[model samples]
Target: MSVESGGGTQAVERAMSLLVCFTDEHSELRISELCARTGLVQSTVSRMVSSLDRQGFLEQDERTGLYRLGPMAVTLGSIALNSNPLYRASRQSAQNLSQTTGLGVNLAELRDDRLFYLANFEGAKSPKSFTMAGRTAPLHATGMGKAILAELGDDYVRDYFTKGLVDAYTPHTIVDAATMERALQEIRNRGYATEVEELAFGRACIAAPIRGRSGRVVAALSMSGPLSELGLQGRQEELALTVIETADEISVALGFTVTRAPARRTTTAPKETAR
Candidate 1:
């Protein structure tokens, strides 16, 4: 590429990193905080922040001197979410599932080997303490993550382990390749994945893969709640079936045709059966 184009690309990347540093947990930050999060010098961050502020992508509080996402960012975020095919396909079904079951519904996609929550709908019975829409979670410790893992290639899975399973989030979180492999196999066999206090101490979730028109596991849908309320021991089968059906419905809406018979697979990649 030409030097001018390359320089422009790098600037764009730096700006994006700065924006990403402002997540749900860190909604506002000072220039120093942005520097710490992004490893960029103060001068660079300051320049970028000023440019972004001028463009309405960020705004600075005059009194507190902290920067936060501005009106343009909100407009762009809404447009992007509404235009996303997975979010569009899953939103209504996710809401309906949460309303019907009184269980929190989550839709997530695997990005950079981590599960990025696209939508989180809280049920009437769900705790209203936190929102997960802009959050990310480890692929080795959550139901939705494991469901997607079950559809990935074995070589990819092995390479993923080289990055180190994130430190265990709870006593039940899978921290070893051997154990996680077994869990993936179980998910493949049962057509779903489940996590009990693996990601959080008191939460549990059941998830199933959502396929695209090309028959690829592009994302996952899940239902989550407290362990005692979900009652895994008593209703595991019923809850699993419910999640699987809802995921399949979203898959169909995304243009994946249903097939009565599915092909057997020997590895972790998606099954080669017709959709």
Candidate 2:
């Protein structure tokens, strides 16, 4: 490459590397931390961060002298989701599912080995609800996360589990890798995933994968509720079917052709029983 080309490539690399320094664990960082993580000179890091800040990609805290992702990044991400046909098609279906099931409905996508909630609808009868939009949840412990993982295959699942430490958010949280793998396998075999008080006590959820035109799973649609209602044996099955059918309808609306044959696993096999 020419000198100018090499300089431009290096600058792009440095900018991206700096952006990667922010993580869930360290959502905010100081200039010294950025310099250490990116291995760039303090002056260069300062200049680059200032440029990013001006573009609204980063925001510096006046009180703490720390930097975090800015509102511009959130605005851009929201724009991308709103512009997607899948998101647009799924909105009404999600609302319908929430209304029909009397449970909170959530739409999410797998990113960075976690489920990122994109949209949510609250049920009419839900007493207490948790809002998860723009939040990330563990893959092994959430119905939406597990549904996405089931579609991504084993290698991706392994890499994901290896990167993060599993925590027992509730007594029912599956923290063992082998057991979690078995759960994912069952989710793949069947067509839906379930979480019974895995993420939080007394909360349960069922989710199904939302496929794209190429038959690749791009997102998940879930119905979540308190255990008192969804925990009943027959009620859970009814809710699971509702979630699956709703997701399928939304996928079709997004122009996803379901060309693959269904898996051989029994749809009646309760995921909660498997656990």
User: For residues 76-173, could you state the per-residue lDDT of candidate 2 as single tens digits?
Assistant: 87898798676789988898877877778999887877788888898875644455667788888888888887778779767766776577888788
How many angstroms is residue 21 displaced in model 2 relative to the true structure, after the best TM-score fit? Answer: 3.1
TM-score of 2: 0.72
| Candidate 1: regions farther than 4 A off | 1-11, 36-44, 261-275
Query: Among these predicted structures, which one has the highest TM-score?
Result: 1
RMSD (Å) of each candidate, 1 decimal: 5.3, 4.4
Evaluate all candidate structures by whole-model CA lDDT and list the values in order.
0.85, 0.81
Q: At residue 47, what lDDT does model 2 achieve?
A: 95
Over 1-275, each residue of candidate 1 has an lDDT whose tens digit, in order, gives: 99999999999999999999987778999999999999999999999999999999999998999999999987987888899999999999999999999999999999988999889999877766777875789888889998899899777778778887567887787787777787787778778888888878888888889999989999999999988778877777788778888998899999998776453222232331200
Candidate 1 structure lDDT: 0.85
Candidate 2 lDDT at 21 equals 90
TM-score of each: 0.85, 0.72
Q: Model 2: clashing residue pairs?
A: none
